[model samples]
Target: MVNINEIARLAGVSRTTVSRALNQSGYVSEKARKKITKVIEETGYVPSEQAKSLRLQRTKVIGVVLPKISTETLGRIVEGIDEILSASGYQILLANSSLNKEKEIAQLKLLESRRVDGIILAATNREETLMQTIRELRVPLIAVGQDLPEVSSVIYDDFNAAKTIMKKMISKGYRRIGFIGVEETDQAVGQFRKQAYLDVMNEENIEIQEGWMQQADFNIQSGEASMEAMLQVCSTRPEAVFAVTDRLAVGAMQTIRKRGLRVPEEIGIAGIGASEISRYVTPPLTTIDYQYEEAGRESARLLLEQLESGKKSVKKSVMNYGLLERDSLI
Candidate 1:
């Protein structure tokens, strides 16, 4: 509860001098600044965050809006963001939008109202309304994982990554390959991965079987249900299934085991998003390592750069992805 007044009284300096020192203003003498700082620290004099923000017109806080807060990929991304922001003396404010456009827009406005210095958004899909709002906002905005054409973004080459995995599977002599993904509205899970699969299959002259392709909500339960549906519908079940995420692959694996099928011997399963659990699963998952943490760190760096430079140049940064082969596929 110690305020600047007590520090001022102890330092025998005027309130103006105390304010200048605390704000790191050039008006304060170096010797006086040190003395005031020592007194403030010794007394534990905490300045009013609201007052400081008002005076400086900067909060030194970054808002991170994640599409799905509970996902493992998002968790690691946030950890990376926190590491970078903490080192830079900036705090993080988190908002979970659950892939809802309305909620995301509301959270953006809330962050703006709180005077956040910048925002890093892990968007669900490209929404024109949300993009327009972000463009009109005063704070620096950086998109992560998904991109807005007019904004700065740090994203993985999702389409190419998926294509690489499909081609690898095909080369390994896996002809009956299935694709389990989220709703097509989700650009990352649907458009990117699904389109890549189709393109690869068509180029390889593989027939497109309706039953081998399924879309769900990108959760374990949805994955399980999708796999079961595929098994029921497909006359010739897929020899390998490529899930859009690790969670989905794990779920599909479980379903396969329950059906008395041995992995790789009977069915092979792989997925995107090389989460931690992917490496620890029973047979270990063969998937693409998207470098979620690197993406997060880069997103933070881009936002910080914009905040410091006061420039709005459109930047598109695509990080590399590695295909991690484990016991599950080979």
Candidate 2:
């Protein structure tokens, strides 16, 4: 309950001096700082965060908006973000959109309303309204996982990564290849990755069959259903499959095994996202390691730099991806 004034009086220094010592903003003599510290310790005076925010015009908090919260990719990215921010005396305020486009936009406005210092959006889509909302934000904003226009972003090379995996499959003589993809609303995983698959197949002059390309939700069960659908409809089963995500790949693998098909021998399979479980899955999934944690760390660094410099200049960082050629893909 002791105030700054009482601490100042006890320390035999002005309130301004006490404030400078406490906030480490203005210059305070070492002698005066020592006196203030002693008085504060004895009085057990705790500074008010609200008052500090009002004075400094900063909350020392970053807003992080995630499209979905239950994925391993997101968990790793958040870990990286927190690792960086916590070291610099800042914390994150997380907002989950539950993979809803409308909720995504709403969360942005909600975080802004809370007066967060900045926002890091793990964007799933490049909707016009979403981009417009980002453009209109008063606080600095950065996008991760999607390359968006008119904003600073950290994105994966989804197209190239997909192409790499697909080419690998083709080189191994997988002419009859199937694809499992999510909806194109998620531009990074859906549009870019699918485009790469199509381009590779076209370049190789490989004929894509009916039901070879199946769209599914971002879940294991959806992957299972899509693979089953392909088997039921396609006159000739694909020799191999490329799933846009590792979870989907795992599901497809399960379906293939359940149908008495052998992986890498009868039905080779590969996927993106080098999740932890990818290693333990049967035959070990061949996947693209997108460096998700690095993306999160980089996003935090960019936002912090903007906050420190008081500049909202647009900056873009394209994260690197690597192929983990595993047993799943022969």
Candidate 3:
């Protein structure tokens, strides 16, 4: 392992200059900084993060808590976060909740105890206990995909996206539209999005079916079960179905095919998230792109800004969504 003295000798700079450039502490001329950077890069001499943290009183590590790491949406968001944070000399400490809501709460405290500079929660729901914990937190926390009072968030326009999707379904002359949703405790995907669908149905005077609304967890298997249950409940089935997520929508498609029904022709289907598999599905899935990755990048920026500037200002940024028209819906 190359030491700071070797780096300084290679760069023809003093040890203090090398220290300032590596630790981002004190000032160094651009020329000296470039030389120091080149030497560090060529020698692959990485400063000890532990010692740096000790001197700066900062870990330079951001904690990220996610409900699950396997989803395309969550993965993309984390990718975006890493794109920005990694370039800025920060590392991510991940905590997976494994689809357990209580674990999400527990991970927050764990990250705090570890003294991570900031935390970004890619959450499913905004529960009361989670909100209370966030409110009491001294460390900066940004909630992604869920809304909580007095907390900084990078949330989607789920309500409007739902409204728009329902409008499209109505315009396509699909009166009876089934909804595959999650637990209402998940305010964004489960409640806000579902409410918008209901409201739009009401506006268009399209009466929803008693068994058309099905609840499922955020997984493909649960979605398949929910669809089967929904069909069993309805004497006359819906002409179309709108699932809260692409994974769920794909699962519904699987069930539809197993039952000898063709998608979009027999039963139109749509979903949100615009997952990578959405386009490759048999008929392709018409879904909403929530720009989740951009949300992650924005959240990282928000957390870093406050951490670097030592400013405590609450910021709630609602990101935009786009309709992805594909063979499934049209």
Candidate 4:
């Protein structure tokens, strides 16, 4: 694909001159326009939709900012979003934050600079600075996985799902269930989910131990570390360990086996996000199916609707989930 820079070099002009001539904006001399036109005509150089949108003011590109690109959940969500956007004559411009919260704010500005028609943010943490940034953006946008009154969001039923799964573990005779969770800044995955676990334990009259609650980042290595930490601090080990995500649960399983504990016997383990790899893992993981793909499709639809209707009304769409009672949490 030939870019605008190549066209500028061929036309013997600066990039700004080429942009002005192609977009018919700013000031381009007649001689420069003619030269640019000649080069474009000879090379059949077609401007990108983004470049054209800058002039005509309609780009069919949707910017998607994700926490990271390496997870199965992220992959599935992007696939779902792309399916809908591509069918509607639109494309995705992806920006990965690589798990850095600050980068999410930067990606929003970067996407706006590219003149995208709209944006869909798969956010992790909803910091005040990020919310302020979203308010200032001059385009239609929707969020997924985190709810904010100021922004339209498509999120999972984190609290209910956590409570339901904890009840299930208790029903199966697991008295003390340890929790492996992320930081509390992420409202959906970190705060609400952990709060649900604690609430359920309180309701069931189960003893809560400080050592049984461990914090982990969103990764397999962190899960392993958290599980190890929980075991080290707890004089009496919990019968079950519930992690917030499948990646973390898998890591906990690794640590459990290293300690010669048998799953569902000495210790049971579970996680949310019925990720693709969850079914293949040894003693297939028991988890909650958060319907991430559906969330992506819905977020795309909502953003497109807002773009077409020019409606800025804040809409919140909460998604449902299902429990997969697999071998890991029998």
- The better candidate by TM-score, 3 or 4, is 4
Candidate 4 residue-wise lDDT, 243-308, digit = tens: 999999999999999998888778999999999879999899989998888989999889888887
Poorest 10 consecutive residues of model 2 by lDDT? 48-57
TM-scores of all candidate predictions against the true structure = 0.84, 0.86, 0.84, 0.86
- Highest lDDT: which candidate? 2
Q: What TM-score would candidate 2 get against the native?
A: 0.86
Query: On residues 223-282, what C-alpha lDDT tens digit does candidate 3 reach at each position?
Result: 899889888899889899999899999999999988898898999999999999999999
- Ten-residue segment with the worst summed lDDT in candidate 1? 47-56
lDDT by candidate, in order shown: 0.85, 0.90, 0.86, 0.88
lDDT of 1 by residue, 274-327 (tens): 988898988999999988898889988888888778787789999999999887
| Residue 91 Cα positional deviation in candidate 4, in Å, after optimal superposition | 0.8
Off by over 4 Å in 2: 1-53
Where's the lowest-lDDT run of ten residues in candidate 3?
48-57
| lDDT tens digits, residue span 132-169, model 2 | 99889999998998888888999999999999999999
